[model samples]
Target: MPRSPGGLETLDPTRQRQFSESGYLVLPGFLPEPLRARLVPEVDHWVDEGLRARSIAACAAPEAGGPPPVLELELAAHGELLTHPPLLRTLTQLMGPSFVFHHLHSDRHAPGIAGKPWHHDCEPNDRGDPALRMIHALHYLGGLDEKVGSLAILPGSHRRSADKTALAHLGTGEVPGETVIDRLPAGSTVLLDSALFHTRRPAPDGPGGPRYFIDASYCQTGARWRPVKPYWRHMLARARELGLSDSRWPELFAERHFTEYTGTV
Candidate 1:
């Protein structure tokens, strides 16, 4: 696999090809120190202050609950991250110039947290068109190491049309041809085709630091994609009200790109 050299501020021909064929791209040191420095504290607050839990509650059962008091994007640094220039440019290069924000998630994975089963995170668009793309940006704030845990990804698996949980039976077990990415620098990021099969392997037994991970997804515009959060409309409205991207990205937070929230499946 070809790793981005220091900065993936822009994708070159080779990087584009890698993503097209491999279903993923590893961008080491993609975030600047200053931006990352600001994001760390926000993650701490999101988790420590119970905001993360509140956010999840609103999604799991929105009829009885309202939007969380604080959204991840509302956090100053998180909001900036949602519209990071390099990320948008790379997405535009890979999935075309038009795409809408699908969702954003932030978490602090404590040491010895349970490993996640192998699965994909792709959300279906109403048109049922597989060609329409959705990409997930996995940001490693403090980076990955033996102690922080690693990500396992099955290359080219996105090409297969299977349910997201099709691979869950394997748990986090290593597959014959999967790639184990355990070593990376702070501020590194891995972009995956949302349909790509991947897993979060827990940190090896030892004293490990909390892993600060934030992920945001974007879907190419053409068809309305299913909304994961019932309060997604409110989320987008707040984003527009706050002018996260100002007037530059007309379609970034537009409500037309999504189907009505159908509640969790």
Candidate 2:
């Protein structure tokens, strides 16, 4: 990724246009090493202690009137990544500065993990406005290589109006015109238009090692977007309590941008 002469992170118009047309942007070694270092252990702990499972269960049974003891954003390094300055600036260039966070998920995929079916992660906004955008920032703390599964994405797919599972029946099989991203340096991040069709394919030669992955999403303001987790209100409140967002991005964790939780979509 290109940086300013000063070595500061920068997003130029050309890259912005590419993201618009390709439905994704690949940032090689985007996160700083220190940040990655801190995030790795956190992911291990999140999974090893079964906190990740509990978080998922909270999403599944949100009506239980409770959430997990700790949210992903509440994790020190995870919160830092969520509001990382470069990420926020790049996002502002792509979708403007007024967007609200959708969700954050952290996981360490074990070797031999099964592939995920082809799908999109976009949650609909109640206004039925297609222009309202949502984007996912997929942080690969350990990077990607042959040892782990690669991500397959359909370029320009976000332009189409379709269900999140429109391509589910196809599973993780190859698709013509699809691009396979199998190699990246540690701390790399992939920014995807939330509506883009994508799939996770297992390592070509079988699993090798755990994949340290975390994904956070944000939606453009102006419409009330649906929430993926039933405990979304609590999630945002906690983010605010932890001061995860900066003064510039007050809406980053504001509850006003989301519609009432209607359970998992």
Candidate 3:
């Protein structure tokens, strides 16, 4: 529960060591109120308007063709969040000054939704360097508690060379040494090494409020990471055109860091 070093303006050595050892960092209330307020309504629109469904369809059958009408970052609040200066600074502290934006996903999980099995989200890099890093910033817009699902992560799991879903058989069942992160204020963000194993456990109660979640990922430079979406070029281009990455972060939205999209690995 070490909160974000307020704006992550200064990455203390202790916090850096904690992230290196634990493979994750919890930044409770990392986002400011205004940004989080804007994000909430946008997430409602994303889900209620069926844009999320259409985006899922596009990814499910890339060969079926055509990109989704909107990418998550194209939404005003989402676009702002993507390059939120404080966030970029925090990321730079962990992955160095150079890194590329990987992808962004926004969703609203309804009450009583089933749990997702334990899995790591790391995608492969053409270089196959374990030292290279891909980090995911998980935004919990409404925060988390028993009413919403809990996130359970195994500390130090990212060091293992296991397949992404190697622990799927265990489902959301408790695992020894796991860290359960169920209590946080609204606008918190948990930064994780994308290879770390984690699971989402459905709320224990029968019914509860929705969970507003959005995740965006980035990769350390020096290797070409796999692209999750077929329209990767368009995504990168739009980010660049929108000036998401400013002078300080030249590589944030660059396309050179990704390999060609290879349909839903």
Question: How far off is residue 100 in model 2, in Å?
Answer: 0.6
Give one digit per residue, the lDDT tens place, for model 1 in 149-230.
9999999999989999999999999998999999899999999999999999988776488899999999999999999998
**What local lDDT score does residue 44 receive in model 1, on the 0 to 100 scale?**
96
| Candidate ordering by TM-score (highest first) | 2, 3, 1
Error of 1 at 156 (Å): 0.1
- The local distance difference test score of model 2 is 0.92
The true-versus-predicted C-alpha distance at residue 70 of model 1, in Å, is: 0.8
State TM-scores per candidate: 0.95, 0.97, 0.96
- Give residue 20's lDDT in candidate 1 (0 to 100): 87
At residue 28, give the lDDT of candidate 2: 89
Per-model C-alpha lDDT, please? 0.91, 0.92, 0.92
lDDT for 201 in candidate 3 is 90
The list of candidate 2 runs beyond 4 A from truth reads 5-8
Off by over 4 Å in 3: 1-8
lDDT of candidate model 3 versus the reference: 0.92
Clashing pairs in 2: none
For residue 175, model 2's alpha carbon misses the true position, in angstroms, by 0.5
